[model samples]
Target chain A: MKKDIAKLLQRKKKQIIDLWMKNQLADASLREDLMSNEELLEQSDELVNALLSKLTDDNLSNAESTDFDDVYEILSGISISRARQGFSPRETGVYIFSLKDALQEIVQQELRNDPVTLYEVSIKISKLIDSFGVVTFETFIKGREEVILRQTDEIAEISTPVIRVWDGIVALPIIGTLDSARTQVVMESLLQEIVDTGSGIAILDISGVPAVDSLVAQHLIKTVSATRLMGAECIISGIRPEIAQTVVHLGIDLSNIVTKSTLASALKHAFTLLQLEVRRKQKETSTLKSNI
Target chain B: MGHFLLVTIQVDLYDRLALNLEADLVQMVSKTGARGVLIDISAVSIVDSFMGRIIGNIANMTKIMDAETVVVGMQPAVAITLIELGLPLTGVHTALNVEKGMELLRKKILVDGEADNSDDEDQPGDGAE
Candidate 1:
């Protein structure tokens, strides 16, 4: 009977797992800090059992076989979880390669008497592990992308904050680049706050925004018109010198909407609209000395 | 329904309701000789181009009859939709709520009353009261 590489590996599962664990632990890039040694061993144990259980003579060389679905699923799960746990690509790549090294070493030992069988099985193991390596890398990238997408949504939610500055006045400070989706969020929040507070004046502070282009100006105009339609006055504040130059150069008509150079001025304008005034008491120091 | 007509739109505006409102509002204006119209649209959450145009028509009709129209309590989404529909509702006064709408309508009437008094012979009549 021709020597079966799958049966040979299956019979020596414990040795293969032991060697694989030793190979991974000895690697210089091994990150014991990110993952505990016990956890690593548990993960390696599950992967070895999954891989060996599905290994057969016919499908030993074919990594794309349906028999390897459980193997791939387990491998992808490890790769993605490791990726989220901050494992580098080099570390993950070394992990798969070390398992291949252990399997080949055992195969070489088992077929030392027959060189031809050993060489053929070694090539098959190399091709199979290489495919697993590709899967690991792909899943790692997908995992990182999911994290980035979630953070982006969080930033959008926290960035637009509508603060009630005074009676009948609200202030919304927009931080970051203004996109169409973000504009919709900002408009909805600002308008809702206006209704809730019964604020007649709304000051939009854009100092946190890095730059202003025509598209941004258009969004600002739309927001202003919407606020006006709600019977509230909208003030665009924090117009830097550069933004002013760009606005004038683009010939964007902000003539009808009120624009202020600073938030302080905008608040002052809001106060004026609400017919409110702020005054300091005179000679408080003299009264304090007389009381003493 | 006094010197001023208060129309509180409590339901979603359909074609027939909007048209009837326009006609009834105009008729009421001429019959009562009302000097102002305060429309409280706080409950309205949706507005289309037809609704926007109907509002403009109401404003115009009231203006021809020498009455001021003040739209009040418009929701933010409804406002954005109206603006996107290219109907800014210009030449129509706006206020935050019904109370503010009444104040705005009274101011407009007072201003127009003063203007009319100035145009004719000076009379010691406070027409707003």
Candidate 2:
């Protein structure tokens, strides 16, 4: 009976592919913009071939059997690629279940004379396809997570940049929350830049930071201490008014570290530390104006 | 190497090595009458609480001997670890590199010398003046 079912599926391979394609195209959620019809047909053909070529009586009821490895591999590949291509989970799920529908249709037609066999074969096909659906979703989610993780790493790498604002001074503008991990990155990069530039002063601009809490305050203190240990003065700037209120309320002592309300003031202080001044060309501009 | 004792810690310090360093550093300070001690720790990557305490102790000892202590070229990770360990090496001075450390030590010694000279001249029994 099992051999008969496998043989029946083998004989109707082309019919199964056509029926699956028709079912997918007929579905309202078909994503034509993301995938061309020919590409869809080619993917469906490959998956159908893998499934039918491996179908046997012994492995028909057990979806976890090794015989279905090729099918699972192809399904996961298609689903994962679809996930990266921005196909919705529903669309990917429909793509697989439609093939199940096609196989069921063929089995039902071939077993019309025997109701008992028809019921048994349909149940087996349903279980196998349901398991495939689960694998596809799993791979799809995994692919999406991979994309998210890569984006996070890239953000962390590019967010903490040390900018040299003067001959002996560097500035680092932090744009995110000051977590311990981010604080480590900020400290390492800032200290390394200070050494590279031989900057005696470092300005930490936190204008882009949204909030300041106790934990964040602790991380900031650690960074400042690390900078001081490197023999460079660390000036924290761009403290919002609310952040000031929060810091005071929390009773966190920032008295030892120089804190400025703006980057401009921080730069001015840094200039004074280096004994370097930025004066306007007042006399030259006045002479030119008088001549004109 | 001149008026200053330069110690470069090139390996991870254990308890015994750190203790030995503290004792030897004090002895050398008294023996050479060095005005400054510069500890270069750029090569030392790992540190523990015991090492941190030893560094603090060395700074304190050197300060008592009328010698300035400057820790130079401290790695960022090591600095953070030391800070988290609750040992800021408070009595110690710090510089970015060996050259800067030397400059700091020289300036400190020169200022102390000038202060001493001024104090001696202020006294009534100063024959050289």
User: Model 2, residue A139: what's the lDDT?
Assistant: 99
Report how far residue A121 has shifted in candidate 2, in Å.
3.3
> Model-by-model lDDT, in order?
0.88, 0.88
- What lDDT score goes with residue A95 in model 1? 94
Which 10 consecutive positions of candidate 2 chain B have the poorest summed lDDT? B120-129
- Best DockQ goes to which candidate? 1
Clashing pairs in 2: none
| lDDT string, candidate 1, A1-292, tens digits | 3447778899999999999999999999999899999999999999999999999878877989999999999999999998899889899999999999999999889999989888888899899999999998999899888889889889989998899999888999999999888998899999999988888899999998888899999899989988988888999999999999998998888999899999999999888887888755566777777899
Clashing pairs in 1: none
* lDDT (Cα, tens digit) per residue for candidate 2, span A1-292: 6579998899999999999999999999998899999999999999989988999877889999998888889988998899899999999999999888999999989999999989999999999999999999999999899889888789889999899888888999999888888888888899889888778899999999899989999999988988898888999999999999999999989999999999999999988887787877998799889999
Per-prediction TM-score to the true structure, in the order listed: 0.81, 0.85
**Minimal lDDT window, size 10, model 2 chain A:** A271-280
TM-score of chain B of each: 0.87, 0.84
lDDT of 1 by residue, B14-120 (tens): 89989999999999999989888889998988877788889999999999989989899998888877877778888888988987887777667766767767653
Model 1 misplacement above 4 A: A1-8, A55-69, A103-131, A279-292, B80-92, B119-129
